[model samples]
Target: MPLAVGPYGQSQPSCFVKMGFVMGCAVGMAAGALFGTFSCLRIGMRSRELMGGIGKTMMQSGGTFSTYMAIGMDIRC
Candidate 1:
């Protein structure tokens, strides 16, 4: 197969790491949202606190998962 060329005409590696990061972020955010919502509800959190907690959980989980997935993909490559 021919190598992929970038806009500057330089050969570029495949997008496996990028894809892994995106997929991991999406999955992690979804999981986080579900768990965060339930945990907040169980704790009786309301309004701003509930929303803030969930958002924080989602961001942390997404970033953590994406970083790990990207590293794994880089290693595989």
Candidate 2:
């Protein structure tokens, strides 16, 4: 038996290349989202720990902003 070429006939190599590209893109997006969420949660936890015992005195005094900035800068690098 002989197979005839159709309108969309192509070689196997092209299909494999396309599949590899699609899979790579999906994996990269998933990894990036996971890391981004983890980093955000870490930042939130750090902020909460810093603001723990001080209560109203420090909140009204505006020292919280400095603590947050310091933590954020450390996380950036």
Candidate 3:
């Protein structure tokens, strides 16, 4: 009483393999695009402009606040 039969009532391996392959690819792409804590820190650290004192602080704070605002106001917590 299963619904996974091929044209001749044979169980189709390709059907399940295609579904698993699609899911695996989606998961792999998602994992690759994930930006976690260390990634955030690295992007922040590397984005500092070569300006000294207030200029440097301005650049860093701009990035920090941009990220904060982008992820902040939309949060429901």
Query: Highest TM-score: which candidate?
Result: 1
Q: Write the per-residue lDDT of candidate 3 for residues 1-77, one digit (tens) a residue.
A: 24567798786544444444445444443443343324545556434332233343444444554445444432522
Q: Give the Å error, residue 71, model 2.
A: 39
TM-score, cand. 3: 0.32
Error of 3 at 2 (Å): 11
By TM-score: ranked, best first = 1, 2, 3
lDDT of the candidates, in the order given: 0.89, 0.44, 0.44
lDDT of 1 by residue, 1-77 (tens): 45679999997766887898998899889989998999989999999999999999899889899889888987997
> Which one wins by TM-score: 1 or 3?
1
The TM-score, computed over Cα atoms with residue i paired to residue i, of candidate 2 is: 0.36
Candidate structures ordered by lDDT, highest first: 1, 3, 2
My TM-score estimates for the predictions, one after another, are 0.79, 0.36, 0.32
| Candidate 2: C-alpha RMSD after superposition | 18.9
Q: Please list all clashing residue pairs in model 3, or write none if there are none.
A: none
